[model samples]
Target: MSEGVVARLRQRLRHQADLGEVLAGGWTGLGPSELAVRPVYLEGSGTVPLGELFDLRGEPAGRIRFEGDLARADRLAAGLAEGEVIVEGSVGAQAGLGMAGGTLRIQGSAGPLAGAAGPAARRGMTGGELIIRGSAGAETGARMRRGLLAIGGQAEAYAGHAMIAGTILIFGDAGPDVGLWSKRGSVVALGAIEIPATYRYACTYRPAHLGLTLTRLRARYGLPVKKRHFAGRYHRYSGDLADLGKGEILEWTAE
Candidate 1:
């Protein structure tokens, strides 16, 4: 695979950036000026240009990779309608906000709202796969309408708040208030989790979906996949009593 222009530059924003507008320029064909142009934010103004910050290579080939640590990068993939975005290290808040399609993979931890909807938006992650190899901050999948969010590590509170439909898998212990006000969604907790009071305990059973989901997480992303996690029994609790009450929390149980 050929490298893109970002592989050749270091963006130290003279101002803030609107990644949405920056990436809008079709990645297929571009010159140095077009590729070097990225939006950044100033004190009170909007974003600035990429050339002012980073050094600016190839072109947008529908796939991009951030090689260095981007702990300060915010909205790394906001409103991304297509393509594959890879973050080599940790990311700031709203890492994949309002993504409609494509794949976002983070090798390290992600700040709050990793796959959450944008502010005032009605939905989040309408369609896509967000793989966080490390832990995720609070509201990791807030207001998710659809898509798959897999956290190989732990997740903070309010993980699936107000989810309409989707699947969230947490390999580590989930914090308090994990899923609240969800209409219809599945929260698969392979580790310890205390189901919300609104959720009523359903019969213990084995879900077939985990097998397919976990397999991809392991083979595609290099996440640890144990035999137990695949064939494990889960205690299903369904609710959101205050809402439509169609969502569920599946806590992996010892058979």
Candidate 2:
């Protein structure tokens, strides 16, 4: 593969910036100069060209990298339909909102609704992979229709709220009321979690799919996968009985 583009932040942001347009579809063919001219919205200052905030480098090869402390950058990779995006630091809310394809990898924490649908949209991420190496805020994958969401660290409340169909893997502690109102999907909890009352315990078994998914995560992302995780059994709970009741929560049991 050719060398992908890199955009390094010029300095710490003074106000939150909306970077939803930076790496959206059709960016893979654009050169560094063409891509840098795209617009971004700032909280108090309105719109400004991306070049003003980030120093663009390299050429687009179906991949992009952002190096910075973008804690105030919101919607960093929203509406992404293809290619690969890598963020080297923490990001603000709605990091991968409405993504359809490709991969969005964040090396640090993410704010609320990281992979969820926008207020006006009908669904969240429909396809692709969202990998967060650090913690994630509340409603991480709310209203998702499809895709894979993996969090390496803790996930706050409502991690997979109202999920339509998808898979969410949380490696650390999952906050209260997880998978609430989900219609069809899977929430895999590797650590502590409190299953909601709407869900009923089903059985403890070693799912064949679990091993396959865990193996891929370990090989591709370098996640901390242990022998226990590979051989351990999971307690399955089916729920959101209030909804379609097809959704499930799989809590890992120690060997």
Candidate 3:
């Protein structure tokens, strides 16, 4: 699989850049020139062409890769509905907000709300996969309606807060209030997790799903999957009973 278009940072951005809907639907068919003309909202400056920020290269294809320091670039892949998008380094807030389909892979930490909904929107990420290979900020998957968010490092507070449905798999320690008020969803914690009082201890067993999910992560995504992860027993806790009580937290226990 080739990296369709490579967008390299032209300069160190001082302000937050909102690449909203720039790589959404119909982007895979666009060339570098076409995609560069899309709108990107800057913090102090209003709307500006994407070409003004990044140097776009490569032919039109089904994937795109962004390089350089984008720590101040927010909404990098917002509203993405198809194809693949890759970020070489850390991203600012709302990395994959409201994404409906396709894959968004971040090789570094995410700011916040990786697959969560916007403030005004009721739903987030109807479908898709978001892979954050580093630590994530608060509310990474808050109000997520559907999709998969795999965090390779520690997640801050409210990692999966208020998730309606979907999966949030954290390979490292999870922060406080995880899965808080989540009606339905799965928060798979491979490390230590903060279980709220609203959650009730369920059982300790090996879930069948973890085996398959881990295999794919190791084979396909090349995540650091240990043999103990598949052989370990998990402590299941059903939580956010304060809401509908359908969500659960699967914390990997001793091997």
Best by lDDT: 2
What would the per-residue lDDT of candidate 1 be over residues 28-89, giving only the tens digit for each residue? 35544775666754435556675554555446566666655566567778766677777778
lDDT of 2 by residue, 162-241 (tens): 99999999999999999999999999999999999999999999999989889988998788888999888999999899
Alpha carbon lDDT at 19, candidate 3: 86
Poorly placed runs, candidate 2 (over 4 Å): none
For residue 251, give model 2's deviation from the true position in Å.
0.3
lDDT-superior candidate, 1 or 3: 3
- List the candidate 1 regions with Cα displacement exceeding 4 Å: 3-20, 24-33, 42-46
Cα RMSD to the true fold for all candidates: 2.5, 0.9, 1.0
Q: Per-residue CA lDDT of candidate 3, range 1-255, in tens?
A: 556899999999999898876886778888899999999999899999999999999988888899999999988788889989999999999989989898899999999888889989998777888999999999998999898889999999998889999999999999999999999999999988889999999999999988988888788677778988988899989978999999999999884
Q: Which candidate, 1 or 2, has the higher TM-score?
A: 2
Backbone clashes, candidate 1: 12
